[model samples]
Target chain A: MDATTVTTWMREIETSVTQERDRLVQLDAAIGDGDHGTNMTRGFAAVVQALSQDQEAPPGRLLILAGRTLVSSVGGASGPLWGSALRSGGRVLGDQATFDGPQLVEVLAAALASVKDLGAASVGDKTMVDALEPAVAALGRTVGEGASLADALEAAAAAAEAGMRSTIPLQARKGRASYLGERSIGHQDPGATSTALMIRALQRAAAASS
Target chain B: MAIQTKPRKFLNDPADVVKESLAGLAAAHGDLLRYDRAAQIIVCKDAPRAGKVALVSGGGSGHEPLHGGFVGRGMLDAACPGEVFTSPVPDQMLAATKAVDGGAGVVHIVKNYTGDVLNFKMAAEDAADDGIRVASVVIDDDVAVQDSLYTAGRRGVGATVLAEKIAGAAAEKGASLDKVADTVKRVNERARSFGVALSSCVPPASGKPIFELPEGEIELGIGIHGEPGRRRAALGSASEVVDVMVEAVISDLKARAGSQVLAFVNGMGGTPQLELYLLYGEVDRKLRAAGVVPVRNLVGSYITSLEMAGASLTVLQLDDELTELWDAPVHTPALRWGV
Candidate 1:
């Protein structure tokens, strides 16, 4: 992806987060603090503003700036988790002006690992990892099979949706939802849902580029 | 709006709750505190008092009389309240730290929630980049859960109030930032807290209860944000609840029969002072019976959840130094003594 394309994807994610803010907040209200939606909205809004100011920067630097903005602007667990993920992914992307399917897969994989490390969560922890890990795996598989970037992203988004759904029955093992213990079983994990939304936004941006 | 059956709270807009509340606070206590509208920080009017280390503390909005209300002569030099249950962003902390640095440095008394810890870490770094010295102490004295939603260890609850009071007094005494931080750390290490929630509380933005507890059900070991507790049990008598909470704290602290402590009984927002006093009586009796002498005590609502109906017990094993600091004069919006 080029710088412009990365910027487009961020804007898409911002729009998606804005549109789905209340839903995400409602989900959090059930099992965690009800500020996830507001926090995500604030973080992404800051990212968009930062991106707009430094539009000439390369994709890697732009993503890094976005991550830093998120970390500074958003509070609560999601801030550090999402911020570190984007920062690590951006660092791996380095100063590359453009990237391809394989490059994007690597970026996602690195981001997923960063989140898992920061949150200390695993696949069954009912966190954003539930959505992000599956999506990364699907993207890696499709990209390794030499699929088009668009196709890989589409597959990744679908896998993320499924992963998010899977969190509904999970006993949370991390994040604020974990405090609910057995009570967390029925409520959907808000972090997973928001991660799915982010992946879907990436797919939409890729399709538009294609 | 479907006939507007939502729970009514004394709020203008959900988003403006913190700002409005801080505005009212500053207005009411203009002589003692100054609220920075843009930065969302409440600072003591006499901030940057020459050659004195400053104490700063804050976290989410619902816990009133905490960081903000305690901003005065002997408590926090500055307070940074965020949106409910959310940590204040770095900008607020950096600005407040810079504004309140009295040439000695600043000490940040942070709660142990993930957000507060991360945000404070960033803020400390940012302030340090500007050559402002910053020291920090993280309070995690609630012995309820080992690891919960966003905490690595015990949640910081009642002990936070003790930390602010004792450490604030240390700063007031012209102690260095490191000394203040060290004193606060000692207070945290020697303190333990336990809480029980009678009912769930709704944030203004959410407009719905956070959790459901059947009538006569109580959640033991509740965090300050109304986060789910360790376990749910049928509502017992006031004495029974107090006994359980006091016992948990005393056990966690490993207090001997002759241990001298400062016992604090704190009310969650919706709980009345009368009920808190009733509970305090039980706590006093229980501590005395256990051979722990209540050398000093505090009772009332200082740190609180948003209208959460419950109480928390905090026991600080005291030493001469801590006792002297605790006895020092304090003048704040919520807490006052020895005028």
Candidate 2:
């Protein structure tokens, strides 16, 4: 994908996150800290502003800027987690003027590893990793099966949605959800829900490009 | 219950109270701390040289001595202070990362609250964009909430202090950022906490209680935000209160025989140390009987709820590394040891 296309995708994700901001926060209020929507919204808004101002910036730089914006604007645990994911992903992409499906996969793998390294949270922790791990795995699987970028991302988004749904019955082992112990079960993870939104945003971006 | 009125006169505008207080705090404790008033960054005066992984944390005001008082050698590299009860915006945290981040990346330590977590994450992203490697650890130790349908999950409480202390030492010992993050995650896994609120905290600006509670009633498992607890019951003696709080914490920890644990008896605010000590005494006795060895102990107001009268307990299973870090010397305004 080219820089312009990636930028369009980010803007679409920002819009989606804003549209569902309150819903995400509502979900979080049920079983996590009640600021997921606000945090994600603010971070993406910052990214939009940065990208608008620096349209000439390369794809890697744009993603890096977006990551920084999230880190600075968001204030919950997810802020850092998502911020690290984006920043690590951007770093892996380097200054590439454009990228392909395999390139995107490589970047995503690095980003996921960075988040895992930083949060030290595994998939079953019932945080965003629940959604992220599945999405990444789906993307890898699609590519291994020789699917196009659009197909892989579509599959990833679906897996992420499934992962988000799976969090409903999980007793969180990470972040504020863990504090609830048994109480944390039976509610969808707000982070997972947001992760699905991010993946869906990517799908939309890829479709628009196609 | 009716609200009580009191004279209010301390410094400049109420909006600037926290900033002014931090200024005075830094001035008084300059020997032990280095304060960046503009950035609201507080670090150990004699911080270790570059190359050591830096541990930084932050949150809103009123939880004084928390993100601030915890700054010192073998503790936090920097502590960013936000507005009262509000998460520090991105600018403050970004400034903190730049100030303390040596060539070695910085680790941002955050609490479990949505605002705090989100803001810190933004800051880490900002740092990385600036070509600084940054990692973050979120602490969610409260066991008061059901973690279910009614609220936004569990709040970060007592275990935060212990996590910072232990994790800070680990970073100081030259652990990589990834390693420190892992250690922090391990501690979070083993730690559980519960709290009680006897009174509500009044924000500095409004000077009004966030919520109301009856004179003879206590809110069980109340969050730091004056959120309703699981249940409210008639107030009981200090020992009885300890029994209820300890029971919740122990059960949450899934306490079993021979578990080595770290116990912290933390005051919410107005609760005096005398009462805290008594509560700790009861807690210690019960823990001993349960066949759990209390490895490291901290008693005082490490975390608070404005001027609320209450306390919380955090119990974390300990290993050799955590115990050693816990035992390490830390010099901060609120907590001092191994001096």
Q: What is the interface RMSD of candidate 2, in Å?
A: 6.5
Question: For residues B38-126, what per-residue lDDT tens digits would candidate 1 score against the true structure?
Answer: 99999999888989999888898899888899999888899999888888887899989998998899999899876788788878998
Candidate 1: list runs displaced more than 4 Å: A53-55, A94-96, B1-6, B147-151
- Give every collision pair in model 1: A175-B149, A176-B149, B257-B291
Off by over 4 Å in 2: A1-210, B1-11, B148-151
- Model 2 / residue A82 / CA error / Å: 17
Model 1 chain B scores worst on lDDT over the 10 consecutive residues at: B145-154
Quote the B-chain TM-score, candidate 1. Answer: 0.97
DockQ-based class of model 2: incorrect
Least lDDT summed over 10 consecutive residues: which range in candidate 2 chain B? B1-10
Q: What DockQ does each listed candidate score? A: 0.46, 0.14
Model 2 chain A weakest 10-residue run by lDDT: A28-37
